[model samples]
Target: MRSRYLVLSVSAFLCFITLCNKSNAQVKLANLFTDDMVLQQQDNVPIWGWDKAGSYIAVSTTWDKKIYHTVTDASGRFMVKIATPVAGGPFKVTVSDGKPLTLNDVLIGEVWVCAGQSNMEIPMKGYKSQPILNSNEAILNSSNPNIRLFTVPRGSKTTLQQDVKQSHWLAASPESVAKFSATGYYFGRLLSKMLNVPIGLISCNYAGSSIQAWMDPETLKAFPEIKTPAPADSIKEVSRTPTTLYNAMLQPIIGFGIKGTIWYQGESNYDNPAQYDSLFVTFVKILRTKWGMGDFPFYYAQIAPYDYAQLPPYNKGGKYNSAFLRDVQRLDEDKIPNTGMAVLMDIGEQATIHPPRKQQAGERLAYLALGKTYNFKGFGYQSPAYDSFTAKGNSAVIKFKNAANGLTSFLKEINTFEIAGPDKHFYPAKAQITGGSVTVTSDMVKEPVAVRYAFKDFVVGDLFGTDGLPVSSFRTDDWDYNVQ
Candidate 1:
């Protein structure tokens, strides 16, 4: 009887160990494929995860009615490529590893990732209450079944995440669009109208997030000269440096092909505008390299004007009236290979940080993508950028590169010009267009050495080219400020 009991106990222990091994060996899909997920169309959609070594895996989609199979590598990683359906779906994906794991209610559509700072995260409902609100009527009628949205909840960490805690795709309707990102909703709507295809927007933006938070740690560490040091306490808490929000939000979706990226940030990095030129180029280079797509359309909105204070001494940090950020953006045109900037100096509000004019912002971004990426003819994509400036006595003559059909003023008068002598003391100046160049002079300064256009935190300038695109803010001086 004792021998029989011993044999039974050993057998039970062996069975339990076997079951545990099998459970650990099985392949599991990421949380992104759970239910009501949207996959990018017209591309090879990748579904990957971890499993036991040498295990066979199979994935089947109902919308396309296709099945794909693969085997786990030595490291237990397995990837299967499946062609996406033309239209959106409420379909299912079934995965088999001896046992079955099914993902229900998926969609195949135009998947776009909307990223930026506070302005991009500002919802439509917030804009509805503002003075310059313009999209209330459009929001009321925004019930499109072909459009879907998935918002990544805001989180901060110094580690890469295999999956987001909570995020699910919802069909875009009047109620949904109102709560989603206003700029993202408008951009998606325009794309849907143009292509006549279903659109999916993945909004993963955080207000007050720095550009560094969206960059990989390795990339950031590789260029320590460019990296801003974090708080000492935060550094010592963890042996491994904290991965940025971009790693958590963007890394998981890297292999997933996206049409393009629409960005509207730069406010947080305004304090150190000098290094922004190099930082912006580095960020774009790494993003393109990681995505495996060379020079895809990357469009961004220039920082709009807003009042820092109502008093004088605006040149202290140079923060109040610095064109440094815009200058860095302008430099990107020459440095970065394929990129576009939508100038918004004309549309910004003087009092509000969150601008209410998102319709024009999104529309302009779409216009650039349409012209540059989709090959839309007769559409103007470039804005007025600084070409060259020459000093002519007490006045400076400035030339622009994208002065399409010549330059014009939005108010039909010259405004928002400032000239400074060798002392760097700037005074409000008057400007007038002469042929393709604008000559600026100020009565207060006898010998004007430098000229600045739209250099205030908030300027009432209407300077634009004949094409109606606003001229970018610029400064001819390399003066350093306390803000640095």
Candidate 2:
């Protein structure tokens, strides 16, 4: 009986040991630090994860053969820093405790995290009206071994996630770039060309994601008015809050530094133009603060024209108009230091949400970064913007900045213009240019109370500066849409 009891006790102890081992296995690091990872170049790379308590961790890379080491805290969290490399390569990282885990095919290159709405998320393959042949040729013939891509799976959570479910890095090829963001690819291509370095693009964008969805929950709590819940009680409700995208997509990769950010957003927030000025400023502040990147170059695209709701009051129903949103964007450019706006007021599709002209958009953003940040000369970084306006009887004369030599109409003839009176009645007006100023007049309004250009959702305006860049929408009135 004593021998049988000893045998039972031994079996029980073995079973308990196996259960403990299984639990520890479940508490592993995130997938982001797996094999074939590409750390950002010229930045402090953060390698972190969960492990057994008090477990000593060591990391090694080709850039520094001297293995960096750290020990897991009480919470099973560990972090180690590694210097960035200018060029990319096939590297390796090994972590050890009792057993060794080796991550292979690691690369050191430039990594950019792309985030925003559907336009930024639009894949190259399904873009309508784009020349499929051109994209196909570019993809198939791609030989840039240094260019790599890692796509963060789309997800929304009220709480921050330690790691994404699954992800892997892929070398840019025809098959890969086809499904990648066109804007991101073009931007990466330009950077790779100019810098002559390896580039890694990290895409963490969602279709139709609002500014509110990208913000932090605490940030949203600060603005009670914006915290409205979606019917399903999902994270989508968080979209109404500012900086929601930053909380989700950006927060995870905050310390994973890159060259800079190229933004293509703002369509979703156009309806609430009044709040955008403050919200945009707040967003920039949050990103810069969280990332510890002091006022790095943030280049964004101005919202392009789209079809307006053709109701009695055209600007209602959360629809987008040009001047209001563009003004908000301009405010960011003027107020935010080390920031640039890529004006695409002339390149947008009138009827489509996802404009197929992504190459131009990407190039324009690259132009700003090269000229302003990289100190490249001879690059036109800005499009002409309305500087000031003067009233002359029934007409208003408008002057512009960044006109280069002078302003010219891209249209065969001058097109989009409107004039309003004290009664707030607006009518189509004719426009003519002299030097860098545009003169707007209409026969119906003998005395103009205000003047507006490209105020509607879609305008056939073709005005451009001497540099051939489009003129952004402008307005001189502040009348409420419903009151009008």
For each candidate, the alpha-carbon lDDT, in order, equals 0.72, 0.71
Model 2: how far is 27 from its true place, Å?
Answer: 9.4
Best by TM-score: 2
Give one digit per residue, the lDDT tens place, for model 2 in 330-416: 767888888888888777777676777787777788788778877887756788888887888988888888875788875477767
Which number leads on lDDT? 1
Tell me each candidate's TM-score.
0.83, 0.85
Q: 251 in model 2: Cα distance from truth in Å? A: 2.4
Which sections of candidate 2 miss by over 4 Å? 1-29, 34-36, 127-134, 228-248, 308-323, 421-423, 445-449, 482-484
**Clashing residue pair totals per candidate (backbone < 3 A):** 3, 14
Per-residue CA lDDT of model 1 for 228-327, tens digit only, reads: 3343324331212234566567677676656778888887666567667676788888988998767877888887777645334334346435457767
What stretches of model 1 exceed 4 Å from their correct place? 1-28, 34-37, 50-54, 62-65, 73-77, 85-93, 98-109, 127-132, 223-242, 309-316, 319-322, 392-395, 421-424, 443-449, 482-484
User: Model 2 has how many clashing residue pairs?
Assistant: 14
